[model samples]
Target chain A: MGIKQLAKLLADEAPECIKEVPLKSLQGRKIAIDASMSIYQFMIAVRQGGSNNPAAMLTNADGEPTSHVQGFFTRTIRYMSEGIKPVYVFDGKPPNIKSGELVKRREKREKAEKELAAAKEAGNIEEQDKQAKRLVRAGTKENNDCKKLLELMGIPVVNAPCEAEAEASALCKNGEVWAVGTEDMDALTFGCPVLLRKMTFAKSGKENIQQMNYKKAIEGLNLTHDQFVDLCILLGCDYCDSIKGIGPKKALAFIREYGCIEKILENLDRKKFTVPDDWVPNEKKAKEAEEKEEAEYDTDEEKEKTGKPKSDADEEDTEEEVVPIYVKARKLFNEHEVITNLDLKWKECQVEALTKYLVDEMGFNPDRVKSNIEKLQKAQKANTKPQSRMDSFFKPLPSKAGAKKPAKATVGSKRKANDTKGKKGAFFKKR
Target chain B: MFEARLTQGKIFKQLIEALKDLVQDANIDCSEDELSIQAMDSSHVSLVQVNLQAGGFDHFRCDRTISLGFNSTNMSKILKCAGNDDVITLKAEDTADALTLMFESPGQDRIADFELKLMDIDAEPLGIPDTEYQCTIRMPSGEFQRIIRDLQVLGDTCVISCTKEGVRFSVSGDLGTGNVLLRNNAAEKEEDQVIIEMEEPVELTFALRYLNFFTKATSLGGSVILSMSPEVPVVVEYPIEEFGHIKYYLAPKIDDDA
Candidate 1:
């Protein structure tokens, strides 16, 4: 959903921005994973699994189905075994701007479910199998169950204020964690210093994860991070619609020709792009200056849809929600509330407790659980220095970055990393 | 009009917790004597019936008969709101579309209320005729549940065989096979793994998932009764005190090779 044509564009324009590294090389790295995204990828794994019936998702004696539990358990353990410490960050209250996107996704899901049911009723196995993959969803119970299971496994789970990707990027930028592991291109738009894609590693080998080095990306594109975000929005982002005819190639050309988003929109032929009626360059500031309490983009449609009368709280809500789409998305990316400055520490694996939870509560096979636990226990017993703590874990990584990473990342970025010294110290302080 | 109250909320909590796995929405028939619900699972591979006599409730009144259709999942959620010691009262009118559940602490200090919107589910109670079985096994519900759970990891279906030797559960798949045999003893107050009475030795294979769902009711009693007839559905029952009971009927898995 994050500028669909962006990856292809990057492949063509900036090949140096992406690198396929061995999954094992990420060993001893403190990674903040997008929990919902990982859960979703695993759900699809079970849904489209060959031969195995999706309806036969693993469940307890009470018929409480848990599709996410099996996949997450295996993946988290896989990450841990590979010496990658996973700190899962879950999404919090969605930004009001994203509410429209969420509604559209929900409608699509409902329609897919209806179609799947109809296909099944018609005794069309092929169509049913195709629609089966479309109707999969990780519901609330599944999410809560995942949190509980991951907590019981002794991994740190953080609840972010708005978006998991943004929180993860903020942490990466602050040098609290090593990188953000997600399949989302939006993580790049959020300016994650390092974005990890193809994270479904346990199943797919070799290309465990593709690291998108943001510094290298910006250097190749010859644009600042802000400009990249504006370009992403112009191409198309989840928060708002893009100009009808504009795409990744055209958007890049526009950014290269014009200085920023404002200039391009100002110079565009209105008949082709169809910019929103009220939209203009820096429209937020203009609207606010015209009238102190004026809504920048009116919340009239949203209010009418919700059938709510105007109140003090409602007015403030509208005021916050009515900002220019790109401005709102950018602000959310910059000011996302995440758990940084907390003790980002890893505790030794409590194998016995993990084994007990898996066997007794989850109904996992005792021998299989024990075997996996044994592997982790053995690793913990032989724990080396570089892999032990969060701060010291990345000492060996910077040199690797110097060799193959961005040429600009060598000297000037050192001082930029040096600027995060106080923030890093705050993050590593023992709780 | 109908109003039923239970001083011990744990019983009501356990009842719904047991039925949740077997049925989605069930019509609870409240009459002059008892409350009963009989419904099949969506796949029709298993049927569950829950019975709670009027005598089991601390206070019960039914001016007229009513069928209250409630989703078991929502019912489980509401039961979670009540403390095990809290008294629970269910209030509903014959014509109303919603049922109110009131939970009051034993000291009457705190009370909470929830309204459950009822559905007019077009499901009629299934009429099950009593069947005399060739083999009947009475064993600790915990033991039976454990065996089913353990063997479940190995295969999708398990064969339950009751011969002169004992009661055996066997499952085999890509992971290899597992056989757990529970023999019987008559005179001992605490029998071995099971107590078996066989008019004729019988063996039947059934979907392990259905058997696992049946075990959700194991907490209702000390022991589970499995009455099986060759080529017929197995009847598994867990009896509650005061004539209340939860019963499951699971169709045997037809072996195509045989």
Candidate 2:
């Protein structure tokens, strides 16, 4: 559903932009991972018979299933051991427009649940296992548990105001993270400079992960970044239905030939072709805004601030007016919020509090927890040399938003700094 | 209160490798004269017994018979770091919840030591009855391992047809069908081939994966003895030289259960 077939099309067309890199080789780099995606993955692993009944998975003294806790704990330790400091970005409330996708997913899960019941009745063990995987859901409880565990492990958890991937991409664009780690290529459409996929240790038979460099992809497509987003929207995105008969290949050719979806729609047969209501021509004002030549001589800092997802900039101009829906979708991507000025400074682990959180409360084996903690300490001593990451965050943004200039970031004030950015009035009002 | 030292670390390493996959956790019972561990796989479909006499170790001492619970997989991982030539010592205080393992090279240089915490797992010992089986066939352990490995590609369950003639292992699935016949040959020069003793012909279908899992102990023994009766579980035994023996009992997969 995320720009259907976009990754496959890119794989075939722009092979050079995708480079395989080992997880260990990502040492000394900070990666922004989509936390909800990782939590959901671990939740599914727990649900679909993670050797659940026979051998208890990582639990605490209360014997509560800490699949997310264990997964985050182990993975954080493993990554930090390899010298890859991580900032886990979690999704906030989903965009209201994504209700359609959510409903569809729920229906699919319900259908799978019914199939699983039948499979269990029929004693089809294999079929039951497959169908059970679909019934798993990662809800608020799991997310909070993960946040606690990550904090215990001294990893930062960024709760995004919207999509985690969007927030991760935002972080990447700000040079706060080396890359965005997510399974979906939507980050590329959202303009993440670099995206990492399949960053798992026990992948079994999975092929090596390849990093997607966004700028290189645009170069390979021989189009501007805007045109590439338009291509993705044409191929279909989560926010809107794509134009009929326009897949990745057709969308690429149309953009190359006509330059944009609106232009391509103009030359098409009215009865034979179709696009989303917003994708079609809304009015002449939208067209006028397109030709208004953008401001020039942009430095890197300026570029970071103006990286206002395509949607934010367009919506800012047409605050009350309607534009193509893809413009709205792009604007939504632009408006999606991320944590900023975060004191992502990893701290020394508190084994006592960690033991209380995991072993005492959650019922994890105390011995295994102790052993893993020792491994973490060894990795920390041998690899991760502590340095200041807050310097870059506190360094004055000389170009824009001089209003919140605090000059320096105190560790205690980081929460306010992260949550205060992007519509503080609306955020508190809604809460 | 407890300490044991082995002349070579190879036995414990091999012991870990043998039962790591089948047994999740085990309770190692230590006494003055002998050390024993008895546990079953999580499903209770199989049981493993590891017995080591005090004489087997270079040094062994225990004031009281106490059980130490451990996760076998974790033990297996720790054992992987041991060198075959290293002399290993296991030490634990009476009230301690952790067991320390010290591995020293034969030359007394380069000593690596680590500790594993024990769990108070309430694992009860199952009383297994001794029953006379209709057939007991002894064959080279490698051959049995190979047969199971080869047929696992074909199906999940294999039928072990035992007759006065020999034992036949066969499996069929969507991939195709395969059959391996091991007829008794008294003149076989490999020491052990297919030795069959059948009161009457007995055929039982057992899960191939469990058999393959049980075969993880192939390094512990050179030959395998499979004993079966009309509808009973298949008893697979691997006899160790001076250490002890490990046995696995797998329930037959009934076609009716499908």
Candidate 3:
């Protein structure tokens, strides 16, 4: 039945009972939660106590675990107790392309943390001083515990290969989940069948709980899900950072008529559009490669028969093995460091050994290791073997004391001097 | 279960004004057609609960139970610029974390997008003792708001004395004393004032600020019902259509001198 018909049926005969639907109906439902979104919410609600400020220690003066615990459990339990079982997803390692964004964020947080520490040290307290507490609350054990508790409650959780919300949306499209529950509109672009707003325990008594069906919601936008996906790509999703000057409403208009990402790009009046330089297929390829590497590392096993060491060359033989660029990149950097430090020549076997060590001993994520190995391989490919400046630069120099000084040719020794002149010219010219 | 889309602006405007001054963070409990918010202030001196009926909104529709995480601050901001009469549409975005509050005014149109951020606010179960109150009074909401406003001018503390004769609200400060005494249906009064009498004497002191904020909310409705004991906090309740009731509780002032 359509949602309206169902809502009507329930509303007329059994309003009270329908409101109390068991949480199980939510099972396998995709919930798109912002990984970094609710940290401030926790800080504001969680009580503080003791020096360590452990999650368990966080309680009100009356000894009640305050809003943080309340917000987490009430919503989680309410959903579970009802039939709408949820798939709780968390974020995993981000692609390197996002490093710049991450770097900027880290810098901002560091500055804020420093100011907060200073304020506490100086004891210049104000209501705004809560901002300091907010920072400490940002990445804390309490939040992690909440996620863990949800998992222990038997909710399916995906450590999303990337953005938790985006991955959750993928699940929605796959029909693994009926709808996505989150506060972010970014999910709409991810193409979920339905997006539920105001779905919480707090507004349970309100007359109407607002829900939007994706098909109806996007009616005016006139864009198919694929086009909408491109719109988000243009606007920027976790996959690709957003293009400047494009937001939800504007991107919707652009993609609705264009029909596809390629059509929009082609039809765009050059003067009106400024595509971000970094928004290209290669960047997406790089990200995909990086994700492949991470997933491989998550499920890596060492085989016994290869006592001679299985190089990435062996990995290349595997059908699904996606070589990561970072693996080779790390080796190239290390080789540079070794050559610069010890003035040694590049050794292929040593690079391979380091890659193996990183994978086996260091327990580096295979995806990450593969990427670094690929980077080193690329560097090796770019340079001519044994002929590049790096190769000769790494060659050991003869020690001053070990070499005999050539006997100074007597100025009048014509026969020996003529032979030496030709030889010296040839060597010096080549150098 | 029952979905009606409200297109009138006045309803939204009135609703926003009614909700603005109340405590921003409160857990509203709802059952079927009834919704209530219960919260005590930091001092435990005052508590306020706002109730509204299911029919209060134009598009009142709910079949299944849902609890919304609403921030009074955000809602107030959205309601601020709304005209007294405007058409607004309220719709659920899905079974998720968003609600669309759309306003269509004469020259301007706007949509206030709100997402309920999950908060970890815990509600402790409070056991309220059931007792026979010494005094119960029904007063006109306008007069109540004025009494609170006037007493606030005197000082932070006020004494509310109710007797068989009438209800007396007085405040004494270094400057002077301010009192508003009204016998049941006395003289010419504003349409908003309707005074009632008590069967017995009940007197208590309370903070004026709490009283001021709490009583001002009575303006949203026609009248307020008050139940009180001399030593305990007062309970002020506003009953609205559709089984919605807003109640405020103000604790008695502790006598430092005594």
Kindly report the fnat of each predicted structure, to 2 decimals: 0.00, 0.00, 0.00
User: How do the residues B91-188 of candidate 3 rate in per-residue lDDT, one tens digit apiece?
Assistant: 44223333456665655565443333322122322434456677877777777888888777777677788887688898887688998887777446
Tens digits of lDDT, candidate 1, A33-141: 9998877776666533345343445666576655578777777877877767788988787776676678889898888889888987887666776677677677777
- Stretches of candidate 3 off by over 4 Å are A1-431, B1-22, B28-30, B93-95, B104-120, B125-132, B186-193, B241-243, B255-258
DockQ values of all predictions: 0.00, 0.01, 0.00
Q: How well does candidate 2 match the true structure in TM-score terms?
A: 0.50
User: What are the clashing pairs of model 2?
Assistant: A59-A363, A59-A364, A60-A362, A60-A363, A60-A364, A61-A363, A278-A324, A278-A325, A311-A330, A311-A331
Candidate 2 segments exceeding 4 Å error: A46-64, A204-207, A276-322, A383-431, B1-258
How many angstroms is residue A2 displaced in model 2 relative to the true structure, after the best TM-score fit? 3.3
Which candidate would rank higher by lDDT, 2 or 3? Answer: 2
Q: What share of the true interface contacts does candidate 3 keep?
A: 0.00
Docking class of 3: incorrect
Go through the candidates in order and give each one's C-alpha lDDT.
Answer: 0.72, 0.72, 0.48
Model 3 Cα lDDT, one tens digit per residue, A1-431: 00112233223322321222222223223354443344335545444444433233244455433345435534554543332345565665554434545666678768887876776677656522554554554444555655554443334445566555556566666565656666555555555566554465454634234444556434434455565456545555433345456555556567667665556556766566665534333344456769775432221121122222223233222423222222222221112110001111222214555445444543446676565545444433322111111111122222222121232222122111112121211210111
Q: In model 1, which runs have C-alpha deviations exceeding 4 angstroms?
A: A47-55, A202-204, A277-322, A387-431, B1-258
lDDT per residue as tens, model 1, B1-258: 789999988788888998897787777777766777877775455778777889999889876566677888988998899999999999987566678899999999999999887764534244465568999998988988999999999987688999999999999877999999988856454423478999999998877888898898877787888999887778898878665888888766543210
lDDT by residue (B31-141, candidate 2, tens digit) is 777777777664444567677888888899987656667888888777777799899899987656678899999999988998887765434465455689999998889
Error of 1 at A21 (Å): 0.7
